[model samples]
Target: MFLTVTLNAALDITYRVPRLRAHSTHRVQEVDERPGGKGVNVARVLAALGKDVTVTGFAGGATGAALRNLLAADQRERPNHARLTDAFVPISGTTRRTVAVVDASSGDTTQLNEPGPAISPAEWQAFTTAYAGLLPRTTAVALCGSLPPGVPVGAYAELVRAARAADVPVLLDTSGEALRRGIAARPDLVKPNGDELAQLTGVTVPLRAARDARRRGAAAVVASLGAEGLLAATADGAWRAAPPQTIAGNPTGAGDSAVAGLLSGLADGLDWPARLSRAVALSAATVAAPAAGEFDPSTYAAVLDRVEVAPQPHAA
Candidate 1:
């Protein structure tokens, strides 16, 4: 089974408004709520693609309960035989919530995120134990999103180590210090956006940045260049994958979809080129979807065949 870790799970709310202006009161045309966080988003995409996936992290309080209920409801609503397990560890503090304000006029998304609850020492220990216990069952594990308060920046590093110990590949997706520490653990793969890549490697050139990141101990570095494409540098080789054309929609969770594609492809034993093709196509499909963590299958199918995967020269 594919496993995803969201240290700070959240109840995500998406608000669609005709337009958003500063200090202007406007009525929201639509409202949608569900469980979210980078890992949960990835799991949603995996489940949609008919992959066996489980999401684990910490959840507490009323919002946490509500999120779990929503997850169970989502699982029940699926017609496919794919399974999605909710394995979140219970905590004492209330889980946080995030809001995505989508401006219908321009399709721009404004995100308001809340920092997750502070984890106590005992709660942290419980999460580690739970994570280690799940490692053996995971074919691959994705460590995603920002660390909750009271959790160390090196948490993902430790999680990566545990997964490695269990002989499971790990996909690390986070930014800033957490990412820096996690890369040192030499995760199987690391996906960072252009800005994060620049911050990590101090290079704006995608290929050079990816190479630098790989040298820092990540087995591979996949840099998400928004509408440009995805640049992947791995031991097998390097390649840049992009869709035939970029479609416009809500791009809120596109990165998570890309992560899902790469992980599912890896679990399926796809090569670097084919894996990147799937990742790029899934990312485009997610951009065309109505909400975060959802992708249009029609778009995915159409783009999958059209994705361009060009080999890139290895930088010395």
Candidate 2:
């Protein structure tokens, strides 16, 4: 089974409007809610792709309960496909909620995030215990997203070490100091968007930035370049994968979908080129979807074969 760790699970709420303006009232055209966090999003996508995945993290309070209920509902709704297990450790503090307002006219999203509830010392210990138990049984693991309040800054680094100690291939997707530390733990892979790459490596060039990130200790690095697609640097080689054209929709979960594709490909034993293709295709499909943590099936199928994976000239 694939394992995903979302230390700060959230109830994701999305709102759609015809257009967004400053200090103006507008009618909401649609609202969608689901269980979300970087890892939770990755797990949902992985499960949709027929992978049995388990999610472990903190959940509590009404929002947390709602996230769990929604997760269960999703599992029930898709019985014939892969399964998703909610192994979240209960906590005293309430889980957080994130709001995404989609502007239909521009196809852009405005995100409003809340700092998750502060995790106490006991809660932190409990989560670590649970994470350790899940590692041995996992096929591959993904450690994702922000650290909730009161959690140590080196949490991902610690988790990466644990996963490595258990002989599991691990992928990390985060930003800032957490990522800086986690990469040093030598995860099998790291997926960072363009902004995160720039922040981590201080280089705007995708290829150079990815290479620099790899030297920081990730076994491989995949940098998401939005419409330019994914630039991957691995020991085997380096490649750039891109969709045929720009896809328009909500791009909130595109990065997570890429993570899902990469993790699933790794579990399936795919090579770097094929894995990059899948990751790029899934990311484009997700941009065509209406909400976070989902991909447009038709788009995914249509674009999967067309994704271009070209080897870089100087991979070393």
Candidate 3:
């Protein structure tokens, strides 16, 4: 089973408005609430792809309860072959919420995120202990998202080492210092967007920056370039993957879906080109969906074959 860790799980609420404008009132068209947080989003995408995913994270208070309830409902709606198990640990502090306002006119999204609840030392210990127990049975683990209050700055780094010790493939998806530290632990793969990659490597160019990131110690690095698609640096080779056409929709969980595609590809022993194609297609498909953690299957199937994967000249 795939194991996903989301230390700061959230209740994702999305608002659809005719158009989002500052200092103006507009009627809301629709609202969607679901379990979120980066790892949770990845797990949802993986489970939707018929993979067995067990999600572990912190959940507490009323908001936490609601998130768990919605997570359960989502599981029930999945196909019979799909498995999504929640193994969230209880915390004293209330869980956080994230708001995504989508402009139906322009199809742009504005996000408002809350800092997660503070986790106590005891709670942190409980989580690590539980994480250790789960590692033995896990096929692969993804440590995702931001570090909430009271969690260590090097949290993902620690988890990456543990996964490595257990000989399980690990994929890290985070930003800033957490990402810097995690990369040093030498994860199997890391998915960072353009901005995050630039910040990590101090290079604005995607290819140069991705190569620099790989030097810092990731086995492979895939930099998500939004509309430009993905730039990847791996031991075998470097390649650029892009969709046939740009898709417009809610781009909220597109990155997370890309992570799912990469993780699923790793587990299936696919080659770099095949994996990059899947990642690009999944990310584009997520953009066609109305909400985070959801993808339009038809979009995914239609775009899969059309994705372009071209090799790049390796750095001398």
Against the true structure, whose TM-score is highest? Answer: 1
Error of 2 at 119 (Å): 0.8
Q: Give the C-alpha miss distance for residue 17 in model 3, angstroms.
A: 3.6
Q: Report lDDT (CA) for all predictions.
A: 0.92, 0.92, 0.92
True-structure RMSD, every candidate: 1.2, 1.5, 1.5
Summarize candidate 1's per-residue lDDT along 1-316 as a digit string, tens digits: 9999999999998899999997999899999999989999999899999898889999999999989999999989886837999999999999999998989898788899998899998999999999888888889999999999999889988998888889999999999999999999999999999999999989998899999999999998898999988999998889999999878876778999999999999999999999999999999999998766789999999999899999998676
Clashing pairs in 3: none
Per-residue error for 277 in candidate 2, Å, reads 1.2
Give the Cα RMSD of candidate 1. Answer: 1.2
TM-score of each: 0.97, 0.96, 0.96
Candidate 1 regions with alpha-carbon error over 4 angstroms = none
* Model 3 per-residue lDDT tens digits across residues 77-120: 76664799999999999999998898889877899999999999
How well does candidate 3 match the true structure in TM-score terms? 0.96
